[model samples]
Target: MRIAVAQMCSGISPIDNARVLQNYIGDAAAQKAEILFTPEMTGLVDRDRARAMAHIYPESEDPVLAAACAAAKHAQIWVALGSLAIQPIESGSEKSVNRSFLINPVGDIVARYDKIHLFDVDLDSGESWRESSAYQGGTQAVTARFGETVLGLSVCYDLRFPALYAGLTNAGAEILAIPAAFTVPTGKAHWEILLRARAIEAGVFVVAAAQCGAHEDGRKTYGHSLIVDPWGQVLLDMDTEIGVAVCDINLQEVAKTRRRIPAIANRRTFALPKDFG
Candidate 1:
């Protein structure tokens, strides 16, 4: 299978983001890609909470979601829209949810996954974020079926949790999508390392479309959209560029890697030590 990853510097305008996504869809289709993956917060990236609140809408009403659907339909390609900020169905903890959607070739939503792990950190760079204050975390993990292959869905911060990948792989996921809008400091230090590790351990292909460059919201993102094979081989890396990359997805590699390592099957569940502290 052939796929495309779009590395973007998403602005604060949903409409503008929609237009950018449309162009990426066209570009990926032109390159004969079957599916296109985009970065997290593909629609809006604003630090001003009050300003961003006005654009937050349900999945049905989100302009970016609607536009992406239309673009996918016109292009006749599937789209693994990395993630979108949408209003949750029922949540009192926060007003919105970080969600990922899988749109089929016909532009119908086939699966949805909300980001279970929220990013709440205070960096030494003096950057702080209380993501939960703006969006609520999801409780369930999700995977999708695409062209006879299984796909695991996850978001930016979820990459840090390896157990999630283990569960996904055990559930028959051959590929994992970890779309992100990572901060510069975290991105430089751990982005590639973590992605490669996940691919190596799970023996699954890891595709990460990332947001890069400075944004209109007075923040910068580390942008190195990466695609790694099951054996931890780097196939494609879009570095610090706002563009799209099309590559082939070799499922055979996944099988070969798993057969070689068999880590997933060899995992043993042991009870934790009691009263260690």
Candidate 2:
């Protein structure tokens, strides 16, 4: 199937972001792409944490989500909305969930995955983020099947956890979607390396759409969206811009690679070492 990875520099307006995404989706459909994916914060990217909290709403009331569903129906292509800030059920507390949605061509939500790993890091460049302070982590892993291909869903910081990818592959995932708004520092250092590693380890195609350039909040993102084949080869890449890339993927590669390596079948459980007095 032909897939398109969309890279964007999202600002702090869901309406404007949706408009940009609509244009990109149209472009992808024009190129005959069967599936299209966008980066994290597809709805909006707000540097002001308080503003983000105030603007977040339940998924049912999110206009961006509704518009994306409509867009999917119009394009007749599966769309993986990277991630959106959604207000979770809370009693007198302000907490939201970083949620990702997979929409079918008919405008049906096929799967939803909340971000399990919240970015909580102190960068050496004086950029410190504590995502968990405002958002709650998800507890479940999700996968969806599109015809003959199985897709694994994950958000930004989840990429750091290899076991999640392993679990997805074990659950029969042939393609993995990693939608991210990776910081410039971390992305420059580890983005491609980690993506290639995951593809090689899982023996699955890795489609990573990323946020690029600087946002309205003075925060910069690393924007090298990529599609890596089972052989750890980058099939398509969008470097530092609002752009789209199309590539053809074959599911047969997953079987071929698994048969050649057979590593997943060889996995054995081991106990941790004890060092008690």
Candidate 3:
């Protein structure tokens, strides 16, 4: 299967971001890609909560999401729309939800996965973030069937948690989608290593579409969108580029790699230690 990843620097305006996505969708389709994977916060990226709140809408009402669906339908391609910033479904909630949508060729949403891990960090470079303050985390891990393959869903911070990937693979997911908007400090150090580890251990294909370059919100993102095969091979890496990277992958490799490793089948449970001291 031929898949495309869109590496873009999202701005604070949802409307502008929508236009970028539409172009990428058309570009991916023109290349005969089956699906297009995009980065997290594809709709809006704003540091000012007060300003962003006005743009965030419920899933049914979000214009960016609507545009993406329509574009996908028009192009006759599937879209793994990395993540969107949208209003939380809970009526009285003030925070929004970081949500991922899987759209079929007909432009219908087949699955939705809210980001389970909210990024909270204080970097040595004096960069601090409290993602939970602006968005509530999702409790469920998500996977969806796409033709002959099954896809495991996750977002930026979720990539750090390996057990989630384990469970997804155990549930019969052959490919893992880990869309991200990582910081420059961490992305350079741990991004590729972690992705390679995940693919190697899970024996699954890992696709990570990422946000790259400086944004209108005054923050910079590390852009190295990657596609790793089950054997931990880096198929394509769009290093700090604002464009689409396409690669053809074979689903049969998933089975071949798993059979050779047999680690997933060999996994066993053990008791934890009683003391932390």
TM-score of 1: 0.97
Best by lDDT: 3
Rank ordering of all candidates by TM-score, starting from the highest: 1, 3, 2
Instruction: Go through the candidates in order and give the clash count of each.
Output: 0, 0, 0
After superposition, the stretches of candidate 2 with alpha carbons farther than 4 Å from their true spots are: 90-93
TM-score of candidate 3 versus the correct structure, residues matched by position: 0.97
lDDT of candidate 3?
A: 0.93
Off by over 4 Å in 1: 92-94
Candidate 2 local lDDT, 172-257, one digit each (tens):
88999999998887898999999999999968999999999989988899999999998899988899868778898887988899
Each prediction's whole-model lDDT (CA): 0.93, 0.89, 0.93
TM-scores of the candidates are 0.97, 0.96, 0.97
Error of 2 at 35 (Å): 0.7
Number of the candidate with higher lDDT, 1 or 2: 1
lDDT per residue as tens, model 1, 216-254: 998899999999999999999999978899999779998
Which segments of model 3 are wrong by more than 4 Å? none
Where does candidate 2 have its weakest 10-residue lDDT segment?
87-96
- Name the 10 consecutive residues with the lowest summed lDDT in model 3: 86-95
